[model samples]
Target: MSFFSRRKLSEQELNNYQQQLNEFKYKITKFEDRLDKLQNDLECKSQGEPLQGVNVINAEEAANRVEKAAQKALPHELKEAFDEINSAVENEQQSVRLFQYELGAYVCANGKPQRKRIYHIDALSKKLKKYGYETKLDSNGPNSFLEVSWKGKETSDISKIDPAKKYVLPLEDTECEITDSATGKAISYEVAYACPRDDKWRIIYDRKICSDAVIVPGKEIIDVPKWVRSIEPIEVDY
Candidate 1:
């Protein structure tokens, strides 16, 4: 004799299976929504329009916008000499960081020659012209910088310098002592150098006591010999 029997799923089992199916459906819906958005973005790009609810700008357009903003920010007297400006903008985010142009000039104060930064746009413009040079905005990889040209020939570039790579010397010739919160040991360290790799201060101490070097945060390092925090950093060959 042959016999066959079928067992039905319990209520709990049925509910679990239903929930899994609903989760799968939800995931499919999300994927479809994403695909639709990508298609719309492609269409907008093909039509030379920005994506909806997203900021986008080309390099040339960004440069013009930055120039306009700089012009407005400049004093009225400097407006005429403001020929062009260079800057970088994140294409997708439309974020910009413009370089603040400076004219390295020297001034005499109290019979001492002191270096002065001339940020006046007009003065910079006039100086550039007097030197038979002109500046144009140019792209350098993903960023932008001013390309200096003399008589229509490219001479040099003015680009943003990494702050951590800048050379610095302590205002006072002394070592700083601080208790290491991590090791609970008193340590003496001197500002050895600025590490360009991670944009942090490299502190050096006796290798016998601690590691050869340790990286310190800017906030902590700035407390020692405060003058190292100058905007116009002193340049030295590492």
Candidate 2:
């Protein structure tokens, strides 16, 4: 055949094309039948009847059960950890909690940073993800706060924290004699503020970020308390 010239089809070729068409039609029909069966199966399930050998369940109910199972499967010491955090958040009307394993350590949401050795991080990741929150696990464990993507926005360098506001813990009746790790000085300091916008906690020495001030862990802490020591939420009144 000349370049760009259409060649007449041979009788055998026409027959072959027809056969291929028939095969495609048969496949399309088979696919449609399967799709219809699936639709009917779903409809029946929606009507409170499951297909043979399949138990129908409400999606939400199923999810609840799965969540329950996940909660139950947590190590005994770690069990109810998430629930405890949630309860505290609910009680305080806050969206996040910051827990430090040690007095001065990487803050984490689910568990203490040092406890990463005992707790299964993958399991924690699963539970957090299932709860519709985004998380990042460092070598130590989960981050200090649970990240939530809003408006279908991709996770980027753009901060979710408010720059104007500071995540300071209640100064009322919160005082500690803990030594400043950054400086080898024994000093008495009250609980300081966390700047989630900057992803750091500033140790306030007489209301100033002194040489001994240290940064706290977390991506954002909009309205969360300045800091918490346990995954169990402590209700801080503002």
Across 1-238, the per-residue lDDT of candidate 1 in tens digits comes to 1112224658874675455545533543344344334545556787988676755545465546445433332332121122221111112211222222223444443344433321333333433343344545444422333443432123122232343543333222223333444464555342223222243222222212222133223323333222123222334333
**lDDT string, candidate 2, 94-169, tens digits:** 3433331222443232222322112334455555444334555445333443332211113322253344432233
| Model 2: worst 10 consecutive residues (lDDT sum) | 229-238
Q: Compute each candidate's TM-score over C-alphas.
A: 0.20, 0.23
Q: Which window of ten consecutive residues has the lowest lDDT sum in model 1?
A: 85-94
What TM value does model 2 have?
0.23
Q: lDDT for model 2, on a 0 to 1 scale?
A: 0.36
What number of clashing residue pairs does each candidate have, in the order they appear? 0, 2
